[model samples]
Target: MKYFCLRLLLQSVSWNAPLRTACSSQTLELKRMKLPSTFQESSKRFVHQVPATEFVAFTRSFHGTTMGALALTSEERFHEPFELVMPGVTFVQYGSIEEAKRTIRKGKTAAVFVEPVQGEGGIYTATKDFLQALRTFCDDAGALLVFDEV
Candidate 1:
């Protein structure tokens, strides 16, 4: 009886192959439409070269939708099926220096990601204390502090 019940549950929770296919197609379309020029990519060396392991990006931050960029996104709605796609990214609440400090203290954090002015997370500005704490924590932890100016 347990085996039968488990089989039924598995069947009910099976993957939606069609939806997956459609989403993939749409993603390809979006990529083509949004691909920046090669010149533009080269113009910004900072964006091109940055080692982001467990980057601490804020919720609703906007970097891009490319797999690399998407990994930094904190919103579940934007990064649904791509949860472990980029692996090692740690998401945290936007505000609160205490939270940031605690998170940084976790160790193995490669980078402390933040926005000087968060545009996607509703145009919110980070507090001075929060930014200061982030800088100090990164310095103490030997982690790179990345400020998303975009």
Candidate 2:
């Protein structure tokens, strides 16, 4: 198609016409192009034990830490080295359809957590298709879709 445009330009046509045609073609090409997602990393989870070990605390296990709740905390450094985390939590790559499918298929998963806009993971929003695929996977595995909205 580009070659055809060049041929038309070389013929006895007005230069303005060919220039407009080339510009419109370029716009169409640009529209066809797609850019990759900027954010594509898993959110980290950190767990901590309670500080108080009193008689009541032993059973109840009250906790103390500078670290805030995991749902809305935007800083990864606050939970650096992610200590004593849960064993079964699977953090797949953001926007990774294959990894999400595999993790969901493991059959023991309790919940599939996701954020529509990953505020901590560089403010990355997932594609609709990716989210749909995850929804399907979670449904098949009988897992809950925990949308961790931040």
lDDT of each prediction vs. the true structure? 0.52, 0.37
Please provide the root mean square deviation of candidate 2 (C-alpha atoms, Å).
20.1
Q: What is the lDDT of residue 123 in candidate 2?
A: 48
User: Can you write out model 2's per-residue Cα lDDT over 45-101, one digit (the tens) per residue?
Assistant: 211121211110011111123221221122334333332333333446777887777
Error of 2 at 54 (Å): 31
Clashing pairs in 1: none
| Highest lDDT model number | 1
lDDT value for candidate 1? Answer: 0.52
The candidate maximizing TM-score is 1
Per-residue lDDT tens digits of candidate 1, residues 1-150? 000000111122223232223223122211111232221122223332334345576766765656556656677766665667656667778877777777775356666656556668477766656666776676666565655443
Give the distance in Å from residue 149's predicted Cα in candidate 1 to where it truly belongs. Answer: 1.2
